[model samples]
Target: MSVEPKMPKCWRKESKPHKFCPGCGHGLALKALGMAIDELGIQDKVVFGCDIGCSLLAWDFFDVDIVQTHHGRTTPVITGLKRANPDLIGIAYMGDGGGYAIGSQHLVNAATRNEKITAILVNNTNYGMTGGQMAPTTLPNQKTETSPYGRSIEETGYPTQGPEMVAAIARDEAYAARGTVANMRQLKGFFKKALQNQIDGNGFSFVEVLSTCPTNWRTDAKGTWKYLEEEMTKFFKVGEFKTPAAKGEQS
Candidate 1:
């Protein structure tokens, strides 16, 4: 007898055939998020907040309550909502541009404040939604719509390591980790741990998902996976930056 695959109840079955581009990593990230919610049995308590950009398309992907915020405002909105309702699990989903460039300050403030929230920062290097512009996390020499001749390190500077930055300001109760969609199991584990941190009332939890934008990156499916594993992984190393377990307590 063959066993059927289990689907996450948190996902809206009607929302099948998501709008994400072919080989896009957004779907993987969403799947991981949904799985985490189901595993933690917090499907009813998750209040997802998605920022403008490609990430905003996830507004209706889940069966749980969701709010779509303007560009660079996802973090603050989720933070406020979580503060108002302490029993809810607030989640902020954002793209590289929304999380690292326009909303960089908000993200830093939220992490430093140790707000009871879980942030999923999807870093695909360039801005995937708006014609492949150079994002704050865009790698040096990477060619984008804005950086036609390849990004200049001296002029554009280096990519921002979001997880490391958040970890630097996070307290012992907080959690920070970096995982890539290239490693599906590890990525889901990171998502689950991040959600658990918030559910445990341990303060803030930040997870950076190194994803891919095949359409914008001008690559096919295989190339996308190769790029994520070879190029992107070199700059944004994956691993947990901080965990509650490090403080002699279970995470």
Candidate 2:
């Protein structure tokens, strides 16, 4: 009789448990990314670059070659990686605050350069690892340490649409999209496409995944998922912004 092969683990089991709050969204996002790579059969060629903020969790979670970049600098690191070795799949994973606020310049520059890589921005709305401070993506009237009374647009301005905002800088409008992970199905699709962008050698593919920071959002997993579903998607619409064909591929 033939025996069945061993099934691969979820990659979450590889985490060191070094740091990260209870039920942190970073863990789940990293797991989803790994599963996506696995599904696409490209884990061997993926180079994961993680930004500061909570995104650093991905550094320890994946078996791929990892790079720890400066706060908001993961973009350039991944860009350079892809440029130098176009055969490798480069991914820059950054949180909302790190990618949109502090690393905003790098984010735009990468798109402007039209570097072939996958940039995944995880928007949890608040600064999760940093004492629950108000972030650039915080919704209207959202309360946080920095915006105790709620985020004031007149004073602080509104949040940035990282994916849509950067699409203009992109070379084409085929693989860029603003999506979320409230549902497993959507999350799977987002990650799968992100990997495909790299494999296809698309100039740039940006996916802003709206995640839940249970600790910073001040809600448990259930409540956080609800908030991500009902409240978060309202601000960041989900859909593709760019999808142009790569050098030698069909749409």
The whole-model C-alpha lDDT of candidate 1 against the native structure comes to: 0.90
lDDT of 2 by residue, 119-139 (tens): 888888888878889898998
Write candidate 1's Cα lDDT for 72-96 as tens digits.
8999999999999999999999998
Question: Each model's TM-score, in the order given?
Answer: 0.95, 0.89
The TM-score leader among the candidates is: 1
TM-score of 2: 0.89
